[model samples]
Target: MYGGVAAVKELSLIVCRGEFLTILGPSGSGKTTALMLLAGFISPTNGDILVGGKSVASVPSYRRDQGIVFQSYALFPHLSVRRNLEFPLEMRGVKAAERADRVANLLARVHLDNFGDRMPSQLSGGQQQRVALARALIADPPVLLLDEPLGALDRNLREQMQSEIKTLHKEFGITTVCVTHDQEEALTLSDRIIVMRGGAIEQIDTPEGLYDRPKSLFVANFLGEANLLNGVIPLPNDATPTSMLSIIRPERIRLAVPHAPTLADAHQRQQANGVVTEVIYAGALRKYNVQVGNNVLIMREHVASDQQVFRPGDQVRLDWLRSDVRLVATETNNGVE
Candidate 1:
């Protein structure tokens, strides 16, 4: 909470041992504040934080022993990579010989073995980030906290660092909590993710769970591209359509070429007739935007070696498996289903 405004409210979460949990949200959503609370940099307004069954809500930041990597890398510009890696050890009163050994081991671990003599300014962005991670881990902390750690790098470097970070997590087997606004990053890095909105937990589940079975409209729209149909969806063999919201992923939707038999085969699946409004090509996949009954839905499909491609102004039918339609609560203030 800040300035008497509730940043996070009625929040309770569990991070499993040795699990990588990511807190994903946009700016001003309180993900970073929650991270600070867990790191002991700030105390919760009225809650307890437990690590291994011990409550540490009031513990000081220095005593938490959780290694944190910030978005800025936060390396000592004047210090060589070796000294930067050694600072934490020195703070813990580790002897010179042990510090040297630990530094060497971490240098090798982060694949910066011969770069220790160089200053942070001399290394590339990715190299310096690796050093930051190495320094965080050199102290042998049980938990790792990362706050948008890849937000500073270029796209290519970000992807590379993501792979490196995942490798490190697998190798170290440490419980990790990362905060980021990037949906792709959360899906790629986290074993499970906590999606935050309005300073509160909107949803908490595995990446697949959140994507495939989102409980709310906000979640459905946030996790990926979703085509939402308002009002009741018409169920086959039912007389009346149920009043609610329905979601279908772009990829789950399939496009069928217009044929005379389509009307006769309508009973087999949920089908809608639409005119193609746009086509997008992106190497491996193609996206089609279709306009149907005052609604525009996007259908994404992989481009097979010998697949037929549809263009704008083409008449086509969009269909999906009955089970692919997910029902959601229509009212925004209503509790999630």
Candidate 2:
């Protein structure tokens, strides 16, 4: 077993150059450990990690030329922002003149151009984070690794920093690997997400691909809120067959009118009926908990300026495109409840 328990089993992953990839999973799913292995903080017992098409399993962390930003900011309290930014360059013996230019440029890039004289304790959490980011980038490493670098900020600051980080990545075109437990953050920031479980890779795909076509039930439930109903394959449609575990996203489900035509017909494809048990108004959208026979289904609809509202105990119908229904492999102990 790896990490004293089967943390990762035969896991292999590849991150393309200049691609922003986020590893997402619940706590103890080995997302951080996987990143640590790639960063040379830990070694994989059974698999190899490659960076830039070269095996990095044997490369020491310091010589790997990868920039890392951690959750703690990890700035030196005694040093000014400028000195902190220059520390990495100093270690590399970069001349004083070039280091000054690089640090000045990085300070501007991270939006701390005038804060160079400030100590870490004198800055706000967000500003300190920006300094940490600038310090990491001062050396201009080929790869960047961020381990929940935005976890300490408030909701507003976190969102702002998310955009800032993305902008910085685009500006530098650096290959970045981010490890995050926040599903929404992963979905928003990553060009692609690698979902992990039990220290193993579950699925790696673009956010749209993973959300629209989950390969397993674990991924379906992890990526977003899924209204999964256990139902037998009644029969294969003459057109296409479905597997045992199939799921549909809440947003894809729609409210249907009883008199609508069957879903098989082209004009009536977006129609199905269910009984509404609960209605939740969540500002931007309304969520309805509907029951179709023994299955409890969830439907989400955007709150329109002029829309009829439904209440609990209302007889409602659910509808969605057939193409939106995704078939997935069975999941074990998904812990979604």
Candidate 3:
């Protein structure tokens, strides 16, 4: 009903005290809307959202006692770092002496103690973001919400801040929910991740659960790169398990050398023979597009000091453990949309 789109539909979520949860999805996938609902910025069309076992359906945003850090640093440019950190305390009317003590502690916590006198414009992007985080935590709110707080920084700085934010969450033990479209960031920061799509909840699990055992095709493809093999389920054998569909990850697929030990001979016949079509060097890993009959499958492996190099237009045999090929429900159409 908001943003001219059905932002969230039939969404129910609960967060325990002091848990780090992340809402992750692509743009327009309703991640931010869900965050807004929890933060009391927008009301839900249906269903109730509870915080700490209490319903906050009609709670006003200001009274929610939640701290939020936005994608943009959203710092007051005219205010010095110290003033910015103290602004929340000032509004809350904490005693000046106590405010100073809290400010000093926070400055040390965020590693911005000496830069407190500088204005927002004077600090670099990373420093400004740290200040924003410090300001949000100033009030010691029950819950912390972050909306793509690292989106503006360069990649290197963004990675660094990710660790800092994670450390802060652990140190403060505050229940936190972060919204981001970045999968890697979500996997890095969240104890549990909620994957959303088309105003609906797709999957909610620990990072490894979402990646290793996705419930649906949408979840499999959205969380990471998956080589969805479009093949009918083979009957259960001594080696193969009976299922409807197979979901293979690129990194799980392996290449075999002719003279090397055979997986089938080793009682590991979970292998597929394919022809290599394209090779891509991705710095840390090598990606290969392999053609298995009419299906093009992806394979990935880490860069090795003495790695075997393969080029396009070479026939290669790909093998994997039967356990690695996850059996997923077969659908008539891929659920990408």
* Higher-scoring candidate on lDDT, 1 or 3: 1
lDDT of 1 by residue, 41-148 (tens): 888889899998999999999988889999999999999999999999999999999999999999999999999899998999899899989988999898999989
Clashes of each: 1, 4, 0
* lDDT tens digits by residue: candidate 3, 96-206: 999999999999999998998998989999999999999999899999999999999999999999999999999999999999988899999999999887777888999
Determine which window of 10 residues in candidate 3 has minimal summed lDDT. Answer: 328-337
Error of 2 at 263 (Å): 9.8
lDDT string for model 2 (104-217, tens) is 998988888899999999999999999988988889898999999999999999999999999999999999999999988998899999998876778889999988888887
Q: Comparing candidate 1 with candidate 2, which one achieves the higher lDDT?
A: 1
| lDDT by candidate, in order shown | 0.87, 0.83, 0.84
Which one is best on lDDT? Answer: 1
Q: Which ranges in model 3 have alpha carbons more than 4 Å from their true place?
A: 3-5, 232-243, 263-265, 330-337
Error of 3 at 331 (Å): 4.9
Error of 3 at 18 (Å): 0.8
Q: Determine the backbone clash count of candidate 2.
A: 4
